[model samples]
Target chain A: MWGDKLSEGIMSIKEQLQNRFDELTRAEKQLTQLLLQNYPASGLGSITDLAKRSRVSTPTVARLVQKLGYTGFPQFQSVLRAEVGAELSNPIDKYNKWAEHAPDEHILNRFADSVSKNVRQTFSRLQTEEFDEVCALLANTDHRLTIVGGRISRSLADYMFTHMQVIRPRVTHMTSNSNAWPHYLLDMNKDDILVIFDVRRYENDLRRLAEMAHERGVKIILFTDQWGSPISKIAAHKFSCHIEVPSAWDSSIVPMLILEALIAKCKKRIGIKPGAGLTHWQACLTVRAYSESSLRAFSG
Target chain B: MWGDKLSEGIMSIKEQLQNRFDELTRAEKQLTQLLLQNYPASGLGSITDLAKRSRVSTPTVARLVQKLGYTGFPQFQSVLRAEVGAELSNPIDKYNKWAEHAPDEHILNRFADSVSKNVRQTFSRLQTEEFDEVCALLANTDHRLTIVGGRISRSLADYMFTHMQVIRPRVTHMTSNSNAWPHYLLDMNKDDILVIFDVRRYENDLRRLAEMAHERGVKIILFTDQWGSPISKIAAHKFSCHIEVPSAWDSSIVPMLILEALIAKCKKRIGIKPGAGLTHWQACLTVRAYSESSLRAFSG
Candidate 1:
């Protein structure tokens, strides 16, 4: 019965960890605290390393693993490894997993369903006041706006920056290069707004940058996933978008949609005449003719 | 009666142009041909310039504008300007338009509904055989893959390139610089795949690049919007995503989702092991101890 319960997915590893938390001895509790802090990383290490880091004996580590309903340390590690794998798998891996579980569903249908749920959940969770506050901050041209997004989210940052640049003159998207970040952060003032996009497995650099910006009294607006990242605590306005998808990779549909809504609100608040900038930009493109001949000289 | 019909928005400018095409005089035909060929641009020019370019008299230009249901040449120009504005409005402008149309609907709800419709329409329009063919080509590891996206689409190209790079080797996203394009194009072979993303207000340079690649026997996969572009004719594989949204700017949610689907299919065909690359990358980040302290020195 015990073996069947362990194999049946009766409880998630995290749930098991929490349920058994209070029952652990002092030495086990020390290791538990370390495990909770370091999380999957602590689980990835060998028994000895976990003991050494937790400041407990190797026997304590083994006992904790067995008590957690695993046969041994390897079994415990396997669960952690699987958890981490699910967290970091690419879209392809995620699709395969979904296919296995729901054999009847078409991949396209699955994708459509996942995206729909994500957008709906995101809006349902958002507070009206918080969204308005973000819009008000963006609309205020006096606050020099600096937007940052991590590796995968760099595209989103670019999207927001491009749209916002046309709406207001002072907006800038920070470059991906870590070296240039400090220079940008140092220039930020109390009145400025620092918009950040950092999702799960949040970057260390982003956290540090947010910390520095907060110190400078820059109003921080953070867009994160449902996981609710560490940076959220420091941000003056924090909004979490649902990124859950059937695949291993988190879908960015919610965040992108939220960005659209925010841009719309900001435009309304700023009273930007529709098509004014677009007309000017299009006229410029027209003047340049934006044609093959104009580009050919450079190609040659 | 004529004024009422004009006010009803029953006849778009293009439709009006087509409906009255056969009734035009010979000089008007020449002007019409020029207007059709250069389109929107033709409407932006002065009457004298249009007459000079089409080798017609200035009165001929005015006659054509009047025949198209406008009060005069200036009225005709105003309609064209409005069309162009709708084509090029930024996200903020788009949001404002949506807000004005549906004041009762929350912006978040509107966004969700728009994105949901976009994804559904994109999938509904996509032919399964074409998607599978695109997937098959991408999965072939022997083929060198090169991706190019227009200015606004550069981020998407980057997103695809980044994900594909991890799944397999030898995938590259082309730089936007015109000077470097020739060098990249010259290296294409029959076995290589050149994926281009150029939506409406299509760039002439992109069209020329596609033409050049076709001459070299390179397989071209073109991803565009519903209007279809000039490059579609030359491409071996063509796919269009629906980008209609409440905003002036085209939402990229559909295209991004399609890319994810393509990646999933390619991964399946290629038989890539689940979590193989992700594990390696995560381990590297872990080894680096991706944290603030590690990044602090760079800031200093």
Candidate 2:
């Protein structure tokens, strides 16, 4: 019990300063600002030097420290110094525990860093409104959905199509054979959603498909990269994520996040279960869905 | 220039204290220790209260504050207050710019948080050596690989199978139908590798498959969750990740990261292109691989 309190009691001096700044006197606030300006460097000096630097009297300085629960300048400096040490610890020390057999800059680490960064940057740049609007379209079971992916993104398209097929009806996954694409286009009605995953070295075939889909008044959601694919001009909703990583291949990390988020949201919107919506053919597909994600529901 | 310097100049006060702890006087150290013990709360009071709490003279406290470049206690407290405010800011505010159409509890933010946490936690727990060992097995062209996944995991299995086929010579993706298992087993050689994805509500057929594979001297690699599937006892390599999220379904976010990382690593290992390894059938398949992730290679 006592140990818990002791552990809980420890917070950094920076947090203390920030939390209690409102209680500071005018001179103290001025002094605090100066200290914060250079952080540890500003505070690593003697009392006389500090007072001189902040243009405050020695007594005033002493009074402020007492107010902050410090015995004197030495104690505060000690804590500040310790914090800086922790902050400056080598970044490599972290990797020591990461991947033992692989050296620094291994594909594992490189890809991890790039993928993590891409997820973060893309999320930061994503607008919630756009995501919500897309989810709303996905929830509308009145309209069918057609999914397609260029060379590499085929697996991703397949992934979405598989999961969506279980959660809702009226979804078709286009095969890699472009020859059969026209048949898919023929069935896509107005306001139907066509989700295309097309990344760089953008395929001419995909561009043409997008053009035809757009002409049919289909609401197209194009998942591309930071550069924004040419299809973006025609896409009703465009998710431009950062997909670059150190490896020869571009990452699908960010785009996949968005895709899953959409699936999850739509599943929420369309509150109906796979078992409830089942046809005999669909039942065969439904049995393969494991129990974890097996709960089928549509919020709409 | 000037703006950059100002940004660089700002370091946290916690960092300041921890890094320069050696410079403190005994009285100041005692007072600083007390302040840190309760953090912001310890320093929020008046000079008399804080000095008494720390059992230090007012002059000693003032001197310490000056030493930290604060004009007085008030100044130090002001900055501390601001930090607390920032720390305590409602997390929803950050999401305001996220999915505006959805409420705070929307699936987007919930899944995002859960997925991000799962990714970070799983990576932290993953052994780099284990990862390298898995990569070594994958890099070995002498061994053919057979991939399988349970209901929901089939897409992931398909994902790995699709990419692996493009990267290596002999790889087979089993369909969801259990009746086809024996046919695949008959083709499996003693040294062939089997990759299985089995999560909660672990299937009986997959366990039987792993058993048959194990009996045949086929190496097994399993991707599971923290609870670990029963297959771990029989499988040679197991990747157990955290899959829980706020939603009803389990997340594949962490497992997918590991999968992609493995693909990136193996691609580096194989050192061969689809074009170079192309048989007539493979050439047809190669035509679809767009530019990114298009460079196929095996390092080993």
lDDT of 1 by residue, A85-160 (tens): 4443222222332223233365666776676656544454466767887888898777899999987788889878
Question: What tens digits encode model 1's per-residue C-alpha lDDT throughout B74-152?
Answer: 7887676555444433323322222222343777667766776666666766777677788888987789999988867
Candidate 2 chain A: worst 10 consecutive residues by lDDT?
A: A291-300
Q: Model 1 residue A276 lDDT?
A: 49
Which candidate number would show the highest TM-score if scored against the true structure? 2
* DockQ of predicted model 1: 0.09
For model 1, the local distance difference test gives 0.72
DockQ, model 2, C-alpha based: 0.11
The residue-level lDDT of candidate 2 at A183 comes to 72
Q: For each candidate, what TM-score against the reference?
A: 0.61, 0.62
Q: Every model's DockQ, to 2 decimals?
A: 0.09, 0.11
Chain A accuracy of model 2 expressed as TM-score: 0.61
